[model samples]
Target chain A: MRVVLPAGTTETALIDGISAAGASPELMAHTPSADAEILEYGEPTTAPLTPVSPSGCPTPAAITRAVREVVGFDVTVVDAGLTEPTGAATVDLDIDPGTDVRTPTAVPDADAIYDRAHGFGASLPEDDLLIGETVPGGTTTALGVLTALGEPATVSSSLPENPVERKRRVVDEGLAASDLEAGDCDGAPMEAVRAVGDPVQPTVAGITAGALESGAEVTLAGGTQMVAVAALLRHAGVDAALSIATTSFVADAAGDLETTCERLDCELTVTDPGFDRRDHTAMERYCAGEAKEGVAMGGTLSLVPDGKMAALRDRVETVCSRLGIDADGSPKEETGSNTTE
Target chain B: MRVVLPAGTTETALIDGISAAGASPELMAHTPSADAEILEYGEPTTAPLTPVSPSGCPTPAAITRAVREVVGFDVTVVDAGLTEPTGAATVDLDIDPGTDVRTPTAVPDADAIYDRAHGFGASLPEDDLLIGETVPGGTTTALGVLTALGEPATVSSSLPENPVERKRRVVDEGLAASDLEAGDCDGAPMEAVRAVGDPVQPTVAGITAGALESGAEVTLAGGTQMVAVAALLRHAGVDAALSIATTSFVADAAGDLETTCERLDCELTVTDPGFDRRDHTAMERYCAGEAKEGVAMGGTLSLVPDGKMAALRDRVETVCSRLGIDADGSPKEETGSNTTE
Candidate 1:
């Protein structure tokens, strides 16, 4: 199984009102940022992992470690305009580091990145391909893409309490800035992503579409961002042979993900990490809704045997404890956003 | 089709016998050697192309351009270890840049590179995968791998005149430095490559073997070095569904390619570029025996639809004329290997 993490930034996430991803605004602009931590969580030694937002989380890495224990896989990070490198193995797609999504064209080379990403996807072997992504402000980008694709997409949040008003406001401005009406990109999916979507959306969509066309069973691993990708595929008339997999946290979060997936004709697989009872407070934050999901946490968890969540939680606890993170899921030292902005 | 070009260096190429690759030995140590020119040749404009050997030839670019016209594809250069960047879209595999091949271990992380390359291969779609590689002096490394594999392999040279004695001498030293006898690596393919092969060998072998496992038809698109890759596959017991495509220059050169292929259980496809009557004398050098083959020039030409050699030739002439390279296949200025030694 191949996990493609296409990372990008969305200016919508930086709005002072935005905090749904559980990162303190101050830590959001750091080089590795929270988006990169998802890949960082895959390996054990933290020495080479990119320095993520101390206030944010890379929850998906814990889930991926569990899946890896069951069936080993290769991790390939597609540099879809990431602000910083994950320090892992990455394929440079020649995409510029993304600017905030509120630009005239968020992904100017969305077309080229999509074409080359398609070729990359086409080059993989036929198997039960599992694809996952991690873009820090990805949920907001999903909101723009989904709402643009004609879905009432109330995406889940990394925080337990959804920042509905804040996210909705950002999406509203993004939609207005987009030359496209909601359904304008319903026909040409690439256009919507170009207008307001983050770098990860089109890249993941292109790879997913390419793999599907090649006759491989694909699992889109994430929350609303993947739904955004599915929406792009659904409208492009290239939709088939795909499903969405995420955590119960995402499924239970404020988003109407169920209806969104249903509308796109995409299947959903929700894995419960059972964070409610975990002794490790940092991990248990999933139950409290502090760091609900990012990375392919839910999809990766679904791949492992159901009972393996215990082993997975133990690993996370070990990691968190080693890093001196406390039960409240905050870093030992206050690194709130560092945004000096 | 996915084409992976992994490049590296083994100091052995700096020897006087290595001239056919069209690189002045001095420029051979520089970044973006002749290997990169093959991919550059495919594009119509020189802009966006990586600068290769100033004193060398980019003959393969013309051949690859022809193939691109027939079947356009993305070029992914895997930096197995290069002195400098090729400025092309590349995957950094993070293996230590190789020292001279005579080292006790030429590729420090043969196992790691192999594993990662397999993931790269597995990630490709189930199509006719084209796998190519370029490491100056790779033929000597191929000789090392094949002879170590128990094959009495007499490999071809990049020069018009065979550098048999020089290449054989390097292989002899490489073989002796390798702690095992032939078939020592029959059960350990990665070991053979690590001990006696260049950085490109294991990476290409792993990807080829991985793609084969993924049920993709793979074409080892190079000459003797590819033969080395095939030899590694044949011994590893994981072999299936692959072939070697190269130029007649390699086939008809002073090497027993047919017998070697037969010994390794490798199928070969040799394309005749009809270089005999080319106005672009820079390209006709293949006919006269300069720069035999580096990159997948020969194999890429083989993939083009038959009877288009003239169009391919005209395109080459255009590129040659624009580059100011003349009929003598020599640069206007002399850049004899500036050995600071």
Candidate 2:
């Protein structure tokens, strides 16, 4: 099995209190690069540190890294439109980082990115491919894309309390800026991405489409963001049997995920990852609805055999120790629950 | 099976009458990118035209493309150090194009390129890998790398006459400029490349080492250029059994390839692709020793079933027809042969 993570960025993430992918809005630009580095090298080398929320929740890349250690799967990071360069080895799609969705032309070259990524996906030799994303403010872009495609989509957030209204307001502004109403891009999926979505959506959808065409079983390894991708595929007339895998945290937080999957005729697999039972602070954060799923944590966990759960926990412990974090992902010198609640 | 073609460039290709990879020396910088474009899209998109020798011998990328159409193998072009951007989707290693061998710092970051390529190679899920090259003036650089590592290598050429003494003179000047003896970098494979080699050498060797470490069966998939990569792997302390596959034209031109493989305890497979019997002018050029091998033509042909030879021939005819070439690869309106001899 091969796991491909498409890393990008969107200026929508800079909205105050909108994203928790990094410790602050300024640091959010480094989240994708940091996550990719951690996934490939067991720690971040390019960025100064790993991605952590202001409330001390570690990014879900740590969980995916642990699963890879236990399951021995291969990971490849694709630079769809990263704001920072990652120390990890990556496949570059030569895309520019997306502007804020309200700018109207967030991802102007979405179609070209899709076509090139489709060619790349057709070249993979793996029989099974799992795709994930790490785009800050991706959920807003997802909401924007889904609304443009005439779907009412409720997306999950990395913070403890999902900021549903803020996301909807941003999408509305984006729709107004692009001179588009709901369903304006209903049958033109790439147009929706061009107008409002981040670069990750077209890239992931392109890879999935090409992999499916090449007779490979592909799983969209993400949360409601992947639901948006599935909706795009359906609107594009790709009538394939597709599936998505993600954490129960995302599935629970975004109540529309199941109905959206069903409407798109896609299967959904939700795994708990047993983070609630772990003693690690980062793991505890997941149970609290912070840093719930990114970097394919749920999909990677799904691949781990029941017998390897203990091993996976051990690996996670090792990764956390390297980060010098405790239950709240704070430095050992200041260990305490740092949840916003 | 996967075929990885690493493309790069060197100022040595700009020396008067040194390279036949392009129609003229000024065009040599575009050869690597053009070859990659042709291999991926069945034609050149970024480049104004496909690569052709000064004498009008078409590049072997056409052959590789036809073989792919017949056998259905996956191909990936790795941008080791391309001067031009290819329209083809590629994996970029963030390397600079190599300087002339006469410059002591020919490939300044050879080790870093090697390490990164090794990581990329280890992530591949394929069990069988075929590695090729598309560097103009690569055979001369192969001689440079081999000599630096204490090997006497006789490399092949795209021109009919072989130009053996000219290549030797260039390497001699390079050795003198670097202030080193033939065996100065014997125990340091990457050092050999950094001193007087092209970026493609270290990149290919690093990928091969990483792929071998990951327990994949690998075949160096070009002519004497691949022989240089095998030599680097051996000097780097990789003792695993390896193999190389190429065409008989290269074996005949490079009479020492068999002995060098024997010295390195490696297996060699040389196949005759039956190009001599084909009526296409581009196919005839191989018989006359104009464009013997590049872009993994020999390795790809080795994968075809004996029964598929006719289909392969027909496909090659189709590719040649698309290029507007006749018996000597000249324009159909002017069908005179362009052979130097």
lDDT of 2 at B51: 64
Task: Report the Cα lDDT for candidate 2.
Answer: 0.80
lDDT of 2 by residue, B59-150 (tens): 88888988987887667778889887665656667888999998877899999999988977776656899999888888888989888889
Kindly report which residue stretches of model 2 are placed more than 4 angstroms away from their true locations once superposed.
Answer: A1-7, A11-79, A83-94, A99-136, A142-163, A170-341, B326-328, B332-341
What range of 10 consecutive residues in model 2 chain A has the weakest lDDT sum?
A332-341
User: Candidate 2: which docking quality band?
Assistant: incorrect
DockQ score, prediction 1: 0.08
Model 2 residue A242 distance off true place after TM-score fit, in angstroms: 21
lDDT tens string, model 2, A108-205?
99999989888767766568999999988888898999999998777888787688898889899999999999889988999999998999999999
Q: Which runs of model 1 end up more than 4 angstroms from their true locations?
A: A19-58, A322-341, B1-341
